[model samples]
Target: MREIDTTRVLCSLAELEVTGGRGFAVGEGDWPLRGFVVKTASGVAAYVNLCPHAGHPLNFRPHRFLTSDGNLILCHSHGALFARDSGLCIAGPCAGQSLTAVAIEVVAGYVLLGADVDVERLANDPL
Candidate 1:
């Protein structure tokens, strides 16, 4: 399991001021990856930085993933609108395609991602 150094606690889940705002970028998994953890009044959501449109990072500018209204996750490369709740582009070039979600759990305001995610094992394993 990859160790997470979350000393820079951005904000507590209860202290999230806005909906669909950006969170910390903790390293996870086997490969080098940067994940954006989104926050809302209801709960939190996490997604890989990769965009489904053209295999590019979603955030063009630093810590600016959502639109001005803060309703959807916007791909700056092509202006794709992804729902914050579902992470699916409801309208855009990559419509119907959803962002790959990484499971996360909020513990005492710190978010912990699934570092040792066995993707291949899960795929090969039958229900």
Candidate 2:
């Protein structure tokens, strides 16, 4: 994955969940990172949090993206389910369509995306 400067600060590793419940910020997006996951061994994975099925956020609530079994990402809009590892819609109307992935990396104990960036401008914007 290329770098995405707008996707910054994926949260402290200490505050992240094991099954990967986390949120971050995208300087260019309407909202900061709302629905995201952090797999301990796979770095960080992010999405627009919008379900492809009905154009709604996948999480039941902000920062809450998970299934009862914690194996899939559930779309609160229609009970659609997506495989967390691939973000592929496995059931429901969104099946086949997937969440858009945001690029990210860790540096100096911080997570940062390194694409579609205007670093100087983003630094000047409010959080």
Best by lDDT: 1
Evaluated at residue 86, the lDDT of candidate 1 is 75
Q: Per-residue CA lDDT of candidate 1, range 1-127, in tens?
A: 5444475344456545544556445434654445577764468777777778887778867667898888788988898989877788998899999887767666666666654644444323311
Q: Where is model 1 more than 4 Å wrong at Cα?
A: 1-20, 23-31, 115-127
lDDT of 1: 0.67
- lDDT of predicted model 2: 0.61
Which model scores highest in TM-score? 1
Which residue window of length 10 is worst by lDDT in model 2?
Answer: 118-127
* Error at 125, model 2, angstroms: 20
**Each prediction's TM-score versus the true structure:** 0.72, 0.69
Of candidate 1, the 10-residue stretch with the lowest lDDT total is: 118-127
Local distance difference test values of all predictions, in order: 0.67, 0.61
The list of candidate 2 runs beyond 4 A from truth reads: 1-7, 28-35, 115-127
